[model samples]
Target: LGRIQIKKTDGTLILNSLNASDSNASIKGLEFDKSLIKYQMYYSGNAECNDKGYVYLFFPDPNNLNQMKLTFMQEPDIIVSCPSGYKTL
Candidate 1:
């Protein structure tokens, strides 16, 4: 029941409102992996999908990682990504 939501400017990656806990769901275009230890959300086109991809990893942020919003890039020109380990309300 998730949907593609926003598109970032920098990487032109698609951002989506995906449920990380949904084992049957796909973030960006990859299968949802509950064991992926997602500390941060990633939006990239290079992630398995030819156009969109989402990855969850610990991004290096000065402030609290949870306090920040999703990050994006404008190059790959083809995919969508989202965060994991937490439900988007």
Candidate 2:
């Protein structure tokens, strides 16, 4: 199943978010695949458990949809905010 494999600075993996892609996100995911992966960025949101919060940044790949990774933040403080349609990955 599709999942968010949260990672850490010390190179650990954790399951932060267990959310399935909504209908719209499923379609949007396909579109995201078609576009070029041009940047390295991060997105932050509330933590899942005892952890403060987390950050997910796109792991780069050349035309590969499965090429992604997450580096979990012990204290996921909001670093920045983007526009409505702007995506971190």
Candidate 3:
């Protein structure tokens, strides 16, 4: 599992890795809105095999009730690698 912390004042992002085996974790890009108090982060490197993808973290303005809704734009793709004749479900 992973943990993310955002500083409200300056939109600073903090990523915490709980597992000892995790490495090379980082944030690739970030978009922050000071006025709306919202942010989107593109991150990668949480997997053991150096998988590439985006981990988006969104924070909406607390005052706006409608903006508080969460939405999933798309389903994540899962990839696995193994020796020949090995089956994965």
Candidate 4:
């Protein structure tokens, strides 16, 4: 699996791939208040394709709103296929 980190500073958005293999990932856009972070990612080789997705961070605790929790969403085209007995993860 690959990992990425998103950051916002002075109205600027930054995306960093925690692993070298994920360097192709990049941010497409973001909401003004930084409530949403959108990015597009590409997959090749065994899982050849591309998709768009977004990550949102929410705070569950009303008292500690500074806490962070992450959620990821993506709607991919049906062009992707996995080998028999294997599933997308």
- Candidate of highest lDDT: 4
Error of 1 at 64 (Å): 2.1
Which candidate do you rate higher for TM-score, 2 or 4?
Answer: 4
Question: Please, what are the lDDT tens digits per residue for candidate 1 over residues 1-89?
Answer: 23445556676645555544454334343343475434433343234334333444443455665653443333354334544343221
lDDT of 2 by residue, 4-29 (tens): 45566787754445565543121112
Q: Clash number for model 1?
A: 13
Stretches of candidate 1 off by over 4 Å are: 1-4, 8-24, 28-49, 52-54, 68-89
Indicate the residue-level lDDT of 50 in model 2: 27
Off by over 4 Å in 3: 1-23, 33-35, 47-75, 82-89
Steric overlap count per candidate: 13, 1, 0, 0
Q: lDDT per prediction?
A: 0.41, 0.40, 0.43, 0.46
- Which candidate model has the greater lDDT, 1 or 3? 3
Ranking by TM-score: 4, 3, 2, 1
Instruction: Specify the highest-TM-score model's number.
Output: 4
- What's each prediction's TM-score? 0.25, 0.28, 0.30, 0.39
lDDT of 4 by residue, 1-89 (tens): 33555566675535455554534434323443434332223222223433345555556665786776655565455655545565322
